[model samples]
Target: MKVTILTLGSRGDVQPYIALAREMIKNGHEVVICTGATFQRFIEENKVSFYPASADLMALMESEEGRDILNGNGFSLLKIIKFSKEKIAPSYRKSMDDFYQASQGADLIIYHPKALGAVDIALYFNIPCICLPPVPIMYPITEFPNFSLSSKKSFGPVLNRLSYKLVKFSELPFIKEINDFRGKTLKSPKRKAGLYTYDINGSPIPIIYPISPFLFKKVDSWKDSVFISGFFFLDSEEETLPNEIENFLEKGKKPIVVSFSSMPLKNPSIFRKKLVQALKKTNNRAVVLTGTSGMRFNQEENILTVEKAPHRLLFKRAKGIIHHGGVGTMSEALLSGVPQIIIPFAVDQPFWANLLYKKGYSIKPLQEKNLEVFELVQALEQVGNKEYIENAQKIKNIIQSENGIHRAVKHIESVVDNIKKE
Candidate 1:
């Protein structure tokens, strides 16, 4: 069978789907991944076919406004909404056209929610399509609050309902706009200008959520169409650590790994200086990743600073991890059984940090605007507590025991089989 998968956003969003696509290929299915053009080389390196969407998005994201959004300040959501309104349609349409041409006889279409046109493209072709959630954006249960929206307080039944309406209402305009574009682009009268909302109890195709079930309160009434696949992680591209780093890990004191991940800080030099001061105060060995921010620190024997290292490999040897609470980073840290200190910047990061905190795997996240050296020191100290390590290990055991990729593949095959039966 031939399967086509579509996704969008940063590297965090694209990586897992690549893992799944490779798994599908191993199972004797032809697989193609359609995402940011920046990942074309990465996808090809993994032996999966690649389709280009928008390289411009990456360039736009590296600009001043993008850096601001990454730093958790100033019109981030509004800017994203505007970009989606102005740019997403044309890029999505072109991507769909490319997919349609490439996947002439494909068996299934799996897509991210951000790829608004894929659902219609699947509908137009009368093929089965599954939604692959990159984060906890859509809630399958009515009782749970949609995590996609920004809330000032802890979510409850009242808040859940309100969040549902607010999210659905906010999406209405873009849904109509995309539908209208699809109607015109495809020249099909069957396509209508409207948003499609799915209920907890009703969905034709399965929704695959690759999150550990232990993190959140589970709903008994969650629809059968919703499947929980433990976090999908692609094997590291850099499987080996630098010899010096490996040798350093072999030394007596366990090191704390600090990384901001792909998100660049606004004033990285100031952040770096503060971090170095805090690390010196703790007297702990540290490895810092300054991604594209060009943060340079005085070379010290105890501290190692580099531009990048594979999280999958590096986190395993670390005593603890300090990072912005990206879902992908959190997942890796959890799987590594290392306690984390999350300093959330923006978007769904705070949600992940809060969830990890509630589950006892990490401390409450330090807000970037209010961050201080003392707070970083406190969080680092908290991560060394035995109870947090014990809790993190328990969660890791649960995650490792689940066969995420196999379960996801099984669901996709079942959907394709059902389509064949129809």
Candidate 2:
């Protein structure tokens, strides 16, 4: 079978789909990944076929407005909407055209939830497609209406519903634009504009969520078409660790790995200073990953600050992790069986933090604006606590037992088989 997988965003978003693609390839299926142009080299390195999309978004994300948006402030949604209106929508149309032209013989399409055009294109071609929920799948869960961070709500179910209503209403224009694009480009009938709805082609598309049940409880009313595959991390064949970091870990004192996971710190100097002060307060060593934000730290004997390192290789030997609570980062930390301190900045970070806290695997999350040296120190101390470690170990066992990529492959195959039979 030939499968085309489409995803966008940062490395966190694209990596899992790559993992699933690789798994599909190993299972004797031809696989191709359609993603950001920046990842072309990454895909090539992985020996997977690649389809390039716009590369400008990554640069846009590094601009001042982009940084603010990432920090959970500023007009991110408007900027995103404007970008989509001017740049992404057109890009999507072209990319989908290219994908369809390239994938002439594909058996199935697996798409990230945000890759809205992929679904439309699949519908136009009458091909089987599946949605991969990189984060929580939010439409309108009666129990938790605010499952999507895009919604605006403080805390109640009514508020959540109101939030969803507002968000849904806000996107009506974009929905119409997308449907019109589909209608003109593919000559298909118009359909609703939500992430998971029946398209013009009258196919019931399945959404595959890559998170474990431990983080998100399955809603009873959730469509049977949705499949939950546990966390998928594309294992990088090249594992390189700095000699200094390796030596620091071998020094015997438990080291806390601190990272913000590519989100820019709101105030880098202040954040770094407080982090330095917090590490000084504790005897444990520290390795801080400053991802593209250019936060400089005073290099001390006990503390090492680097631009970036692969989490899959580094998280394994770390005593604990402190991060931005990205789904991918959280998955790595959990799989490492180490406790974490989640300092959620925006988007799905808060949700993941809340979920981990409820699961008893993380310390109470420290919002970036409200974070203090003492709070971080306290959280680091709690990492050594037996209960947190025990619970983390249990979660680790469950995650390790599940073959995420294989499960996803099987589900995709099932979807194809069912479609063929129909």
Candidate 3:
């Protein structure tokens, strides 16, 4: 079977799908990844077909307007939509065109929420599509409020589920663009409503969420169509550390791995200075992963900075971690069995940070705006506490037992088999 996977956003968002695509190919299926043009080479390197589908989010994050959004404490739903519309305007046409062309002759399509247009594209082709989100935001969860809502406080289970309904309603504005694309670009009946959510067969698409159930309980409200596959990780081949990193690790106590993965800092100088001060105050050594920031720093005796490293391998050797709470990074930290100090920026980051804290594997996170040196030092110190280390090890065991990619592949094979029988 020919399988097409559509995804968007940062590397964190696209990386997992690539892993899934590779697995499908190993099982003797043709696989294609439709994402931003920036990842075209990376996708091809993995021996998967590549299709350009969105703007370079890293470029956007570095733009003045994008930096403002990231630096802001938080944004209301409308504000986020407004900023997103502006960013999506220039590339929206090209993205739709790319997805349409790439999806041709595919038997199945698995899509990220950012590529909602894929639903209609699949309908037009008379194929099945699965919704795959790294987070559980696609469906309402009575376990807690929707992570994007920015309130950690829960009113009740009813209100928790209602929060997701509000999030769904917010998409009403995008309906026109979705239907307009369908009408203008593809040969299909004009959608009656705005969003192309349902399949041509009038069934709710199956949704596969790749997150560990230990992190958050599955809600009883979801249907059988919704499946929670554990965290999908693409294991790397045995990686040798750089000579400098190897030397540093061999010399003293394992340094804390500090990274704010692709998050554009408004005042990078100030952020770095405070980070250095915190490390000094706590008298801890660190290896900072500065991804795409083009950030250069004069390394002190205690700190070493690099453009990148294998997080899965590096985190296990670290004393602990200090990072922006992107789920990809959080999963690595959990797997490493090290306490984390999260400095959340926005969106679902705060939710993940708070979840880890509640589970006793992390210290209370410091919001980006409130990231003072003293507070950072305090959080660093908390990582050394015995209880935090013990709790972290417990969570690690649970995550290591999960087989997310294998489970997702089994389900995908079932879908393909059913379609063939028809």
Better of 1 and 3 by TM-score: 3
Across residues 1-422, which tens digit of lDDT does each residue of candidate 1 receive?
A: 88888887777778889999989999999999877788888889888999877533555567676666555557567877776666655565566556555455777888876665676677667677887877766643445566666523447666665565543454454555555556666665543332444421234546788877555445543557577777887885546887777877887588999888777766777777778878888888998877865477787768888778888888978888988888888899988989888887677788888777876888878865657999888878887888988987888888888878888898788777876786
- Cα lDDT, all candidates: 0.73, 0.74, 0.79
Residue-by-residue lDDT tens digits, candidate 2, 321-354: 9898888998999898888889887778888888
For candidate 2, the C-alpha RMSD (Å) to the true structure equals: 3.0
Candidate 2, residue 221: lDDT = 39
lDDT tens readout by residue for model 3, 1-422: 89989887887888899889888888898999998877787777777889877656656766766766666636466766787777765465467667888899999999987775788888778888888987878777676788777547876888887777664454365566666777788756555432444334566677888888666564666657578778888776755678888888999998989888887665677778888898899999999988744356894879999988889888999998988888898888989999898887767788888888887878998865556888988888988999999998998998889888888899888976877687
Candidate closest to the true structure, highest TM-score: 3
| Whole-model alpha-carbon lDDT for candidate 1 | 0.73
Those runs of model 1 whose alpha carbons end farther than 4 Å from true positions after fitting are: 72-90, 140-143, 150-155, 165-181, 190-194, 197-203, 236-238
> For model 2, where is the 10-residue window of minimal lDDT?
145-154
lDDT of 3: 0.79
TM-score for all models, in order of appearance: 0.89, 0.89, 0.91
- Clashing residue pairs in all predictions, respectively, total 0, 0, 0
Distance from true position, residue 402, model 3, in Å?
A: 0.5
